[model samples]
Structures are given as C-alpha cells and as structure tokens.
Target: MALMITDECINCDVCEPECPNNAISQGAEIYEIDPNKCTECVGHYDEPQCQQVCPVDCIPLNPDRVESKDQLMDKFLKLTAQKS
Candidate 1:
C-alpha cells in the first residue's frame, strides 16, 4: 500500500528527500504521497524510508489505496523504466 501523511505531520521536511520514487510533495497544507509513484520503498529498501525517518509517526499506509507487494513491485519497475 502507498503511504500517506496525516494532518499530524509537522512538515518536518525529512520524508521528501528520503523517497526513492520522489512521490512525496508539498501540498497546500502538508506533504502528500502520490499513490501512483509510491511503492512503499519495495524496489529500493526493505522498509519504507519515509516512515522510518518521520519523527511525528504520521505516515501511514493509505488504506484506500491498498495494493499487494507484487503490484508495488510492478509500479517500482515501471518507474525505473521511465527514468531510463
């Protein structure tokens, strides 16, 4: 599943640079995660880097955008292909 930043986010600016997929962006209020680009760090890290670095613990899986591990890997592969 893609992760999302909650309103509890303090805008700490730590998670943005940590995203391998560059899925996190500053929104009107807080940082937002683009589901299309987020693979929960599957292709890059064993764990979600953003979640590890978020001090507020506000990043959580987007339940509404639930996806299996294989789906996440597919997205990751597609993203890497676009870069090449």
Candidate 2:
C-alpha cells in the first residue's frame, strides 16, 4: 500500500527529502503522498523512510491505494524502468 500524510503532519519538512520516489510534497495544508508514485519504499528500503523520519507519526498506509508486496514490487520496477 501507498503511504499517506495525515493532518497530524507538522510540515517540519523531514519527510519530503526522505521519499525515494519523490512522492511526498507540501500540500495546501500538509504533506501529501501521490499514490501513483508511492511504493512505500519497497525497492529502496526495508521500511518507509518518511515514516521513519516523521516526528509526529502521521504517515500511514493508504487504505484507498492498498496493494500486495508483489504489486508494490511491480510498481517499483516500473518506476525504475521509467527513470532509466
């Protein structure tokens, strides 16, 4: 599943730089995660880097964009290919 930044986000700006996919960005109110670009760091790290760095613990799995590990890996591969 993709991750989401809830209203609890402090906008401290830690999470934005941690996203390997560049999925996290400053929204009108809080940081937002683009489901299309989010892989939960499946191909890049053991855990989601943004969640790890966020002080408020606002990042959570997006229920609306749920996906299996294989699906996430597929998305990661597709994103990787696009970059190449």
TM-score of each: 0.99, 0.98
Candidate 2 local lDDT, 8-84, one digit each (tens) = 99999999999999998999999999999999999999999999999999998999998999999999999999999
Best by TM-score: 1
Position 32, candidate 1: lDDT: 97
Report, for every candidate in turn, its global Cα lDDT versus the true structure.
Answer: 0.97, 0.94
Q: Which residue pairs of candidate 2 clash?
A: none
Write the residue-wise lDDT of candidate 1 on 14-65 in tens digits: 9999999999999999999999999999999999999999999999999999
Name the 10 consecutive residues with the lowest summed lDDT in model 2: 60-69
Please identify model 1 stretches exceeding 4 Å from their true place.
none
Deviation in Å, model 2, residue 39 alpha carbon: 0.5
Query: What residue pairs clash in candidate 1, if any at all?
Result: none
